[model samples]
Target: MPDSTAPLLLKGYAWLPDLRRRAHDVPAVPVRLLGKRGTALHGKEAVDFFYDEKHVRRHDAMPGPVLDTLFGRGAVHTLDGEAHRARKALFLDTLKDPARVAALARKAQEEWDRAEADWRGRDRVVLFHESARVLTRAVHDWAGVPLPADEEEATARDLVAMVDGFATVGPRHVRARLARKRQEGRLARLIGELRSAGLPPEPEHATIARAVAAHVDADGRRLDPHTAAVELLNVLRPTVAVSWFLTFSAHALHRWPEHRALLAADERHAWGFAQEVRRFYPFAPFTGGLAATDTEWGGVTIPEGSLVLLDLYGHDHDPDLWPDPYSFDPARFTREGVVIGRDDLVPQGGGDPAAGHRCPGEDITLALLAALVPRLARLPHEVPDQDLSIPLSRVPTLPRSGYVMERVRAEAPAPVG
Candidate 1:
């Protein structure tokens, strides 16, 4: 098989889907990546199959570049089995708890309010950059990480760099590596300082940084300072990364102006709008794991130790699964009493988050989007003439012009509850 590493780089999110299409829409498509045998699977069934720990393992599956740029080494994303579960408990507590999520949402709204006020005076503001800063402040303040006002913008840039540069080789990749090293060092020192000061009286009441500082793994060992720093970035980076979705939300509202009225008028519609933005936009292309054992699915066999990629982008846009999948329609999610299936609409990963490799911050992502995107729609701002075209060839692509806005009306409506 021809190595797909170059094609994947050139084609970005469309690579796997286009490959499967050319192969007559096979359920399992075999290929080579970096001289290693690999298979990519599609559909909701594939999500369940890929997440089954008996069939696949995440340990040692991620590329070194991904570890260095996106998820840090020793981060929860790299763990599996009991160790994964133990580490995941910390995220589940901090990210999944309803009250904690609500608090973060509230903080995000407050930060947006402050930033919107500041934007009014500026001639032009980039929604992507400004929103990142808003989320940076919100996550840090909510997580009890002391980010001084002056450092907030720099931190946001670093967080964005880590995600932006993870998928390519170039100056962007260099920026990502340097950002991770700088942040990991900064956060490791903070973890040490908190440990020396002693843990808070109540663990339940503790901040995320404190909780991570004190958490012990399944093997009865606390994460080392560096690993703890990685974990802290695990929390911080994803929240800031939501700026991508938020910016996409701005793009969506501009392209499809009808949704803005619905999103601004009804809170439920805003939730649906958030879901639609995640689905319609390009974010994660796929997630990979190593085959834990020889496994057969859809009449295809995957040998142990081979690469197994669950097709996230393809599955979400699968026409059979989603009628008119290419269309941007929030109403698909807004149907009365419509409950999203665990395996469906996986703009993130799929399967049960608590027991599997799914992102624990999924709830937080949705909540932050639900809380902030509506406010964005309600804010009176003009979309200036700019290059809003999103390139599909860029992994984690965004609007080329960063969705510039000008002639802003700063007197936005009150934050959504």
Candidate 2:
């Protein structure tokens, strides 16, 4: 197989889909990535195959660069089997509760409401950067991290840097590493203080920090301070990363102004719009796991220990699954009685979150979007002259202008009936 590391890096989200196109839409494409033979699989059935623990495992699958920047060393994302389940339970217990999710969303909405007023005073504001600050403040409060008001913007920038730099080997990657180091050190110190004798009691709703600090692993041992800090960041980083989706939401509304009225008038329409943004936008390109044993799927054999990547971006855009897959239509998700299947529409990973490596924060992502995007649609603002083109060749790409807007004003509340 030809080495595709350069092509994958260069092509970004277009790499796998382009390879499949060249192979006449083969079910699986054999190629080399990072000097290892990798099989890229697409479609719903492939989702099932890739997520099966009997066939593939996450241990050692993520590269060292990814571990240092994105998922910390010894984080739950790197575990397998019983150990994974134990660590995952902590996330599920805290993040999956309805009240907690609502609290996080409410905090985010509050931040957005406050920031909207501030934006009106400025000549221009980058929605992407501003949204990151909003989410950073919200998640910090919701996660019980006690960040000072002045540090929120810098913290948000670091969190964004971690996500922005994880997939590349350039200056962004270096920034991500430094950001992770700074956050991990700060968080580890916080964890130590929380564990010390003089700390106040954990609040009723602020359970994330306390829960992580006190969690016992499958081995019946508490996580080391640094590891606990990593897990805490596992919660913080992804929540703030929603800024990417929110930025994309701004792009969608700018490009298709017709949807704005529907989204602003009806909350359900806003939710549908959020789901479409998740599906249509380019976020995660693909995710990989190593074959635990020899596995066969789509008539192709994946040798044991070989890399197997599930094509998330391709599957979301696959014509067989979505009618007019290229169209930016939200109505496809709004029809009555429609529900997105677990193994389908995986901008995050697929399968039951409790049982698989799927992101436990998926619901949090949707909830934040549900709360914020509607506010964005309703806000009175002008999409100023800017480079709105979203280049596909950049991993984690966004509009070149960061979706700038000006002349911001909040809409008046509807008169009570």
lDDT of each: 0.91, 0.90
Q: Pick by TM-score: which candidate is best?
A: 1
Question: What would the TM-scores of all predictions be?
Answer: 0.97, 0.97
lDDT of 2 by residue, 304-384 (tens): 999999999998998888889989988888898877787779998887788989898988998999899988888888887
Alpha-carbon deviation at 265 in model 2, angstroms: 1.8
List candidate 1 segments past 4 Å from native: 412-417
Clashes of each: 0, 0
Runs with alpha carbons beyond 4 Å of true place in candidate 2: 198-206, 413-417
Residue pairs with colliding backbones in model 2 are none
